[model samples]
Target: MTSSAGFTASLGRRRAYWQAGVCLAVLLGAVYLARSHWPALESGAGRLAVADQGWLLTGAVAAAGTWAASALAQQGAVVRRLPGARLTATQFAASAANHLLPAGLGAGAVNLRFLMRCGLPPGRAAGALAVKAASGAVVRLALLALLAPVCPGLLRLPRVSPLVVAAVLTAAGLAAVLLATPWWTRCRRALAAVLADIRALHARPARAAALWGGSVAFAALHALVLIAVTRAVGLPLAPLQVALLYLAASSAAALLPTPGGLGSLDAALAFALTAAGTPGAGAASAVLGYRLLTVWLPLLPGLLVLAVLVRRKAL
Candidate 1:
């Protein structure tokens, strides 16, 4: 009895530490945004104030739909049906958690825990995440291919400088060194498990359709959010053109490891908007509007949901 009590206490302490870390990250992220990007944020909010309310409402609806799309994709990753309401709620919470840490770590940990709690083995839960990620990437790529033709010369490949080449080479060498170790063996096994799950999911036609369809809809809805924001702010770009720019900008931003692609995405998106004939200030305002709907506005409620889920042992 004493041992059990001690174990429970230890677990409680770990949870406390994790919660503290999340709080710290949120505080730091807020500070950074205020300190570094206050001007843009303020300007954008002011513009959004006068912007079209109807279009802003459209953007909000699209943003909300993304959670449902994510829930669908997540369910498609596993054979077992996750409770629909909980899954959607988890996606909202995960988005909130996603902004607290860099490179998707916060969201990944949250989803992994939720999956395990839903009765998946650790390996299977991890594989399900992998499947979801892979499908999202593939869907993004396919959409990019289909949309690229609409705006020719809009996305020219940047000249690869020697520095970029050198970085790639260095990364490859490091990856090679890592691959020589026991870690590589574990990674290989993990890859195999993920592949098996992928095969299992694809074997079921409904699951396969959900996986791909949800992924496509998720990306499209996100682009729609940005496009709607641009319209709200009266950016000159047409909706299709804006959508293409968003896909390109987001794809490039994905290469950078930021919390919710905060800095990287903001920069890339602003640049893309400006290059597409928007004034610099207008681009900044549009990006700010997009962030408002997707991140800042939803953040508090998401964190509250996360806390409630933790209390309920949902994650």
Candidate 2:
């Protein structure tokens, strides 16, 4: 009887694994079909035949660098030392997982599990994630402020129409309502804990430096990839200008809660490039090249790593 029960439990676990694999396959298939029919993506794929291969390769290399930077930032968030190889691999896996879940949920879930496994309490693990996110946002804004003066007219916001004003007001109202809820106090307490964690983590100069430096490098690497893509497609924008545009467009797209910023980010990037005077076809090509390097190329390998880590119980 005991042996039969154990066999049945093992069979159930295998069935669950099969179900997850099928779901992931379905999701990837749907994304591929959607991209195939998207006109901009179609044009960009065609332009790839004529693009400079060297520049595209450079962009791909830069994409890889972002994963290392992310791992560094995550390590810096906590006082406990994490295994370097596993942490980096987790970041690589997280990048692929981000596409599978919405609003950063996939990566966040993976990292949270990692932190818990590292022996951090659940609340502290969450606080560490918050600190990393907050620090990253600050670094991006600081970079934008520094670059705006150098890249004049490159980060222009669109003229605010009545609809924009209404949207802003409605958002503000919603935020106020949210804050008035009973849950707001809990949120405030969570924020306070996160702030305390940040203070403690930053007390060590090395930790502070790693956190800030890794964040800046991570954002910069992303911009560099975009710049490389632009050059590959023969767009004439300066590097600083392209970087600034990337920051602005990415910030704007973060407002949307999509998985991996898929649709919103791509559209915002294409718009920003065109606004900065790149031809429409070139902008489309650039976005395509950038996505190809950052998303499509690493996706399969990242997922494979994710599967390995899961099977090993590393995440």
Candidate 3:
């Protein structure tokens, strides 16, 4: 029994190390991807200048709140207490890093390092991130389902040919077989640690609340940011419709693997806006305004905060 337990713990460590390595690899790719795609999106963001100042400010506030929500979610993921101010600052920096790198490259590395600095075992730290990510995905999907009914036909599933579906299934099956055969034992060992961590987390009511609440707030707040921007630019869509559209666009953008979901998200959002009865020009401006509030505005300050945290070795 002792030997089995020891092996599980070691496998957990391996999984954490593996996760960290993947983050670093993606960070490098994010750098490459961000540079290539930056110029394409840069031009349209300036159009947000004409949006209503009041609505823009509201979106700006919502954008900032995303980081706080992230911090809260992070705090709730682990049993230990994290220093609130420092954690929020780290999230700010992480956001900048996420923007610069894309996906979660910058942000994941930042958070993972901070958790380690706070004395979490590498495995547990990595598990915490996994739990947070899983919760966020769940909340996003939940919101999407709930909002879909309110806005009829706002989000439509594209028709996929049977051949394409078959190909995807085949690919997935092959990959699963390739990994499952050799790594099944090790994978189970690692998953044991993850499941144990999750069980422990759920045992505490407060942490569970924070975990789910922060996740819900994070998604809702982002949608609110987009809604405010859309309204500011005089998009014809209702606020609820805008929220639904943003959720759908963002959910779809997850498939593209773009750093920070940049080109894909921008394109998807504008397309969604146009599809949902927004004029073409209005859609473009709305997308621009949303990006301005969420990305361009806070970028510098976030980077500076990131620098401060690194200098202080807080991340």
Candidate 4:
């Protein structure tokens, strides 16, 4: 009887190992294929070679500042003071993870875990994230509206084709189905909690100020980084125009539910720069340089920080 039981256990272990190997192989294959097929990944490196190093360095510094800005906004969303160092590390990790998981789930999950660890109830923690996101979105739009007038022709969007409209409607329909079916009850509860939290947060003047101010600074800094990259790539567009184009492009990219807005954001940014009077090569170089600073360069370090934070039980 003991021998028979041992044999069964060994077989089960083998099967599990085989399954894990198969899954890993599939994932790697998909990634490899994607890199080969995607023009952004293919051409970005080529453009980076010719990009001006000094402007790129400046953009990198600006990119690094974004995590700090995000941390500030997050801290301001709640009344409890979070540990500054840990909070910044968490934001960096979240940004790295955002590229791995789809539809912003990576960052959301990280922040949710961090907030719960900070002693908030699950609902309240989720509410805090909601408040932060809503505040950021509102501030971004406000900035766009404010800057559009100053940028003059930067706000002009190209004519949308019929295919684009259909694609949008299809995406909306899918989202509606998912909301209506799978998690409606939980979503309703979460929304209610978030609304309550938002009201309470707004009632606190200091927290409100921090939240709104940090959000505005975050958006502005991101635009500034892109503007720096554009200049580095020899794109001659005005600073205000670059900032406005960055805002508009980023807002459009947010609609696509990809991880970290990867391919969609790259394409949108390149198109926006080109439409704003930059040469195609220059626009491509600018987008690549900006992403190199913000995403590719920091990714490894961010992951290392994430692992350390996890080991230390900070998140």
Candidate 5:
């Protein structure tokens, strides 16, 4: 029995290795396909390099702030149930996994696992994750709503009409309702029963406020990062226009199931940049640079964190 169990474990490890190898191959192939537009990316990078160093610094700060805000939001979601869980560590691991693992689901899974490992009940963990997801959706929707009125100018190059904008917003609203209603219905009785339990351990309202505010700030900063890259590469789009395009493309990419939305994000951003009036070459460069900061930069740290967690038997 012991030998059979060992063999089974070995086979499982080998299968995991094979799967990882396949994922890596797919990722490389996608990057190669993306590289066909390298000329544009090069020009954009050159343009950005020629810009004032201030823009680069500002972009870095903005990116960092965005991550910090997101960490706080995650921390707030679980605070009520897992009071003893280390929020900072949880955020780091979760964010790292979100970026490094294939499919965005990895981060959420890691978060739930972490909470469970720390002794939180499954129901509470699920509830916290649901709340966190809902809060994030609310923040994104609010930003989209705020930006909806001015979308005409942003979509001017693409000639996206006001009717289209309205339709998109209406769809988003419907989707949100659909997603929430079923969950609410299923959990209604449980929620009612646990109301006192939940209320007794309420998360800090101030933390929640900060989390939402920070989410908006992070979204704004993300746009600014792209704008800075555009300036660096000498692309000609206004800040607001760039922000609107960024938001639209990013929101669309989030729907994709690819690891970190890899290929989808690049393609979407490039298209959005073109729609915002940038030439193909410049748009490609901005996308590459943005990926550099957002994806590649975090990869090393993510791997390091994963290694540490594994060593500690925490992953």
Candidate 6:
């Protein structure tokens, strides 16, 4: 029995390693394709270097704000169930991992593991994660719906329309909400279960509101980051125009199965930016820079966190 168990463990480890390799290969291939537009990217970077630094700083702050909002949302979602559960560090680590690891799966797994380690039952932990994710989805869709009317040009794009975008987003949001209705109905129980596991925090209405507000702000900040990238690359486009373009590009990329949305994101962003009146080269540069800051720059820290988590037997 011992030998069989050891063999099973070794097989599992081998499978995990193989899966990681496959993910890495896919990520690398996508990245290589994204880099194929390097000449244009270089030109765009040159233009961005001459743009106002103040706006860029604001963009950076907005990104950080998004991170904070995400953490707050996680905290709020789990508060009722895990009253003392503090997920700030776990949130950061998970976000970092999501950005670093291919396909965003790592972050979700890490979050689940984090909750389990914190002593929440599997069902409740899963429910909390579901709620947090649902909240984020609703917030993003809500913002998109609100902004759709203001950006009719986005609707005119090939294979898309404002009404269609709105409908799709609304449907997704509704589906998520409906799927979570059971959990929401049991909110009191869920909250109590979560609260029983931790003792350092308390659930509050204000915190929940803040979490939602932060999520909205994060979505806006993400839009602003794209705008900053465009300006930095010296793209000739209004901030609002850039923001809309960024939103569309990002939305499309998120739907794709590619790791980190690599090729899809770059291509979509560059195309959308150019359509929005920026030069193709300049748009490509801005998109590249945006990826650099939001994706590549955070990879090292994410890997470090993953390593630590592994060493501690938490991952």
lDDT tens readout by residue for model 2, 1-315: 999889879978896566455545545654774466467567767887699999989998999999999999998898888889999999999999998766687999999998898899999999889999989999989998999999887777778999989999999999999899966897999999998888898798888888998999999999999999988888899899999999998988776556687766777888898888887667888888888899998999999999999999998
User: Taking the tens digit of each residue's C-alpha lDDT, what string does model 3 give over 174-274?
Assistant: 98896767567767777788888889989999999989999999998999999998878776788889988988899888765555776678778977987
Instruction: Report how far residue 138 has shifted in candidate 3, in Å.
Output: 0.2
Q: lDDT tens digits, residues 89-194, model 1?
A: 9999999999977668788999999999999999899899999999998888888898889878777676999999999999999999999998699789989889
Candidate 1 vs candidate 4, lDDT winner: 1
Per-model TM-score versus the true fold: 0.86, 0.86, 0.84, 0.80, 0.71, 0.70
For residues 1-315, write the lDDT of model 4, one tens digit per residue.
Answer: 999889879978996566445445545654664465467545655766877889888888889899999998998888788888989999999999998865677899999999999998887887889889999889879888999988776767679999999999999999889787736776788788888877887889888888988898889889989988887767788888988888888888776656687766777787787787776667767877888888998999999999998999988
Model 1's C-alpha root-mean-square deviation from the true structure amounts to 5.5
| 1 against 4, candidate with superior TM-score | 1
**Candidate 2 C-alpha error for residue 124, in Å:** 0.7
Ranking by lDDT: 1, 2, 3, 4, 5, 6
Q: Give RMSD (Å) of candidate 5 vs. truth.
A: 7.5
C-alpha lDDT (0 to 100) for residue 203 of candidate 2: 91
Cα shift from native, residue 155, model 1 (Å): 0.9
Candidate 6 — what's its lDDT? 0.68
Which regions in candidate 5 have their CA more than 4 angstroms from the true location?
1-36, 45-51, 79-86, 156-204, 310-315
Measured by lDDT, the strongest candidate is 1
State each model's CA lDDT, in order. Answer: 0.87, 0.86, 0.83, 0.82, 0.69, 0.68
Residue pairs in collision within model 5: 40-281, 41-285, 47-232, 48-232, 48-233, 103-259
Q: How far is candidate 4 from the true structure (C-alpha RMSD, Å)?
A: 7.7
Model 3 segments beyond 4 Å from truth? 1-47
99-187 per-residue lDDT for model 6 (tens digits): 54545666677888877887777876776676666666778677667777877766454787799999999999997896677645666
